[model samples]
Target: MLATMSTFELIDEASDLGQAVIKSNVYQHYLLAKKELQADPDAQERIRKFNQLKDQYDEVQRFGRYHPDYDKVSTDIRKIKREVDLTETVSVFKKAERDLEALLNEVSEIIARAVSESIKVPTGNPFFDNMSCSGGCSSGGGCGCS
Candidate 1:
């Protein structure tokens, strides 16, 4: 039988896991992609313009259709958003970000499952959303659904 770990030991193990994750390839790639994105002048300009347009859109959103420049601002925001999304640096950074998120989610799921299969883990995927607890505790599954 395995010996139970003290709270301090558990916390120490968690800290080690965190350090390992920071040094992982997925995280490194994400950092590199982010750095590249920040260094890209064109990409930065596009993102800046998109944010400026977004702020205008937010202000006009409060007035809805009553705002005079609402339509124009909305159109500009959409156009700028498309341009920003199409930028190669932005695209690479976004893909890296998603990959890093997936890695973290997988690690979280693993840790959760180690404790209990019924533990809910946010996977950022819609397909497995309802798979955490198929039956409630009242159904005799003891899945901690209370």
Candidate 2:
């Protein structure tokens, strides 16, 4: 069975990548600050600062990837892929297909509203409204979110 993704699914996936990039960059800055802190003459104070930075970095890492809710959704999607007979459940599939379509429409509308309100959608350059993928890398692995 072939799985299809909607444009909004792509958008959400892209947004996930965008958030990951931000988190990774912050973590890198954190590591750098940590190293700088380590060399300070006040050893105990520096040690405390290092642990605090480390905890914040670790918390962001956990928030970005190791969440229980994400694990559950991943598991559910996998299970559905393996067990559901797409041909046998046309109505169910069709209903879900419509739901996804509706969801995508809603997402687009939200973005339009944000744009109209002069709110910047933080995902990256807005050029994806017309173009295609260009594989690139960031020193901080920001996924370029473009």
Candidate 3:
């Protein structure tokens, strides 16, 4: 017979898992990269400028407003982003950031799948086509995840 775990036991286990994640190589690299990025003033300014430009572009698109300068600004932003990505410090930080995110997502999916199976809940369709995944869908229109 399998031994049942108490609520406290489960909580303790979760805490242990969290501590392990904090000690993982992915998490350590993320922290180091973040610190390096924060210490670099030039990189900080570039990121700020890029974010501001992206916000402006998004705002215009959100309102369905057309501006002649939109294309030019978009092109300039892309060029700036490319340059930023080419920088060693920022590039390393970005890769570390992505790695941390993927690790978190993998952990979340594992927990979700376990709970779903235990409760007899219907998980997502296994065979659904993912060709349209833009990795940015929100409201589930043609944005994918349809």
Query: Which lDDT value does model 2 have at 60?
Result: 54
TM-scores, one per candidate: 0.80, 0.23, 0.65
User: What is the Å distance of residue 21 in model 1 from its true position?
Assistant: 1.0
Which of candidates 1 and 3 is the stronger one according to lDDT? Answer: 1
Model 1 lDDT per residue over 113-134, tens place: 8999878776665443433443
Sort by lDDT, top down from the best: 1, 3, 2
lDDT of each: 0.84, 0.47, 0.72
Clashing residue pairs found in predicted model 2: none
Point to the candidate with the largest TM-score.
Answer: 1
> Candidate 1 overall Cα lDDT vs. reference?
0.84
- Residues 18-112, candidate 2, lDDT per residue (tens digit)? 56644664444544544544454454453455555555555555775666455555555444444333323333434444444444444554655
**Residue 91 C-alpha lDDT in model 3:** 93
Residue lDDT tens for model 3, 1-146? 55567877988989998998899999999999989989988888888888988887786666443775677777877888887787777999988977876677567667766777333222233234223332334454654444
After superposing candidate 3, which stretches have Cα over 4 Å from the reference? 1-5, 59-66, 112-146
